[model samples]
Target: MTSQSGLTRRLSDADEIVPDSEYVSESELRHGSDQVVRETSRSLHDNDTDAIMQMFTEKEFETSDLLEICGPFLLSDTAYNVMYMSPGIINMIPDTSGAASLPVTSLFHPDDRPILTETLSAQTHDGSIMARLKLKDCSYAWSNITIRQGNKNIHRALYISNTDELYRSYITQKKSIATLEQKAADLTRQLEAVNKELEAFSYSVSHDMRAPIRIINGYAHILETDYCADMGEECRRLFDIILTNTGQMNQMIEAVLGLSRISQKELFITDTDMPALVKAVTDEQLSAVDNSDKINIETGNIISTRCDSVLIKCVWKHLISNALKFTAQEATPHITIGSERKGDKVVYYIKDNGIGFDMQYAEKLFGIFQRLHKRTAYPGQGAGLATVKRIVMKHGGNIWAEAGTGMGATFYFSLPVTDQ
Candidate 1:
């Protein structure tokens, strides 16, 4: 039972062991010991030192030869107390004084000490464990730790290999993922605050501004009916102008209110007969205007779709009235309403041969208060398309338009088909 340190001291003088002997050179000794050393280490793991000692004796090698070939490792008792530290281990450590007698757990990071203790206590021979070790400079490095039963029943061997660079990359990636998740949460809160502010603004505009406009229109109407005869021609003309301007203002207020309400409205979806709905809206629009006779309306066999009937009706009313108003100058106006299946959705379109607009401003058409034509040419507050867009979006659908000046216009909307 030679102590590991005594054996290590003798191995330093190994060149003198087989010197000037019969035909055996130093290279031959080393080559023959390579295979024998590998077998000894394997047998050491299996606690079979009898075979290892027999092989060494048969090869005419001493215990110092075995110590020289065993390579770098640490020997510890079952209690994890360090018994021996190889010369390689001493060279790698920046501070090697008193390292051999220290607890083997002192080599690992404080947080990793418990994990190493549990793994060794389990005496698991199935596989190796891994942990971060404390380097001599107080920095940390990752290493794979293998525990094998030693030749002595009370002793064990620990084999450690550096794996620091790969573990550091893994830690960096995990930190980046955590940072990205925090940023995403912050953005979501900002978006929620902005939405709340918008709702409050819409409510204020709808309620606070309508009262004064209503009062002005009411006064103008009273003067027109009660004081018409008492006024001169000039006064009468001025009164008529005031009344007409007030009427336009009232239309503007109604349009703003409609746009605001669409944002707060809830949708109730059902199978709606679109052809009948379109016919009813068109008939109502035609009856209101005296030029219904000049307008030729054509409707296709539209498929029934699942949608909010009230909201969809509003969409049809705005589109139909827009066609009628723009085509007032034409001696004969043509308006077509139809629907077709496209992929998983039904695309419905309203096409009109009316005073169309340039396609370049198409993107702005659905914005609030956005209009291509002047108020004089088309009497509107420019909120019709904006309202239509909101309603379409609330139903998880989309709206778009195509037009060229005097070439008529077509407005298309898509709704997903419901599963049967």
Candidate 2:
């Protein structure tokens, strides 16, 4: 049981005494009783007086005793039995400590000491010491303290509590939050870097790749037209193959150039006839190949919705050409262009009975220079599909493919009729 300081009355024997108003308690009367008079009589009751005087005179207890003058009084070792005062008297007398006198200054919280002392001296039973104490090994502690009173010989005690564990836990949680935030920032930076690289690579595909392709294509055109008389037929065929390769290179370069251009174009948005546009692009692509007699067009009425005609026409051109190229061996290649209305948006599908792709390599298909088929088998620079993807994305549309190895391919694209 923790003891607190308090005050109470004590009964005593009547005496031939100075009939003053009141006398000290039995505990306090240990110094002198009313019957035991002393008038500079040093030799009289020398032992008991010295003991009581020693308690007051000792330098160790002096300042502590001064503080206890306004503290609560309690029995030495019990929290149950206590003594104190009324509100008015308590208001008059300011209390300073919560427990009995045993050096509490060492236990004082560094930040609380000054405020505690000044506020304690200012008011009685008002304010409390609620502070974190500095402990060993740089830890913290918490305590709630209040003032109490003892006998005329005032003494005080201080209460303490430790909070090192809770403080450590709080610090750990804050560090976790900071670590997560830092990781998020790192990921954001990494994403920005990846986007920049993609943009730079797209620019290279447009500018760097086309310069050499133009030289080869222009020279090949001159050779096939003007130098046909000088070369053997077999040699001419080889030159024609070279011309074909250069033309394919030109196609790939244009695809990437158009992709890069879509990013910079002013979004001149207006309602467009999607069905008519698809038909027109399909006819133009097939006429270039001169293979429509071999490849069959599926339907006259597919779907017409709002879109950028030039951009959408480019999209149709690439999709249709890819279908024609891959299905060249088919005796009757079938290509169907259609659109499905999903909720408020329209999704376009170009279904082709062609040499389709495997689903496993779906993620890599849109990457520039990533080719699923060998050059001997497919004969492309591998950028046409990537261009189609970029253009759709720039228009706030999503494009995807569904195909299985040896099965036909189906391309789907979704777009909102409204522009942002």
List per-prediction Cα lDDT, in the order shown: 0.75, 0.62
Q: Write the per-residue lDDT of candidate 2 for residues 168-244, one digit (tens) a residue.
A: 66567768989999999999999879878878888788778878878987888787788776788898889888878
Judging by lDDT against the true structure, name the best candidate: 1
In candidate 2, position 119 carries an lDDT of 54
Q: What is the alpha-carbon lDDT of model 2 when measured against the actual structure?
A: 0.62
204, model 2: CA deviation in Å? 7.8
- Per-residue C-alpha lDDT of model 1 across residues 281-338, encoded as one tens digit per residue: 9999999888898899999868779999999999999999998988888889999999
In model 2, state the lDDT of residue 18.
Answer: 31
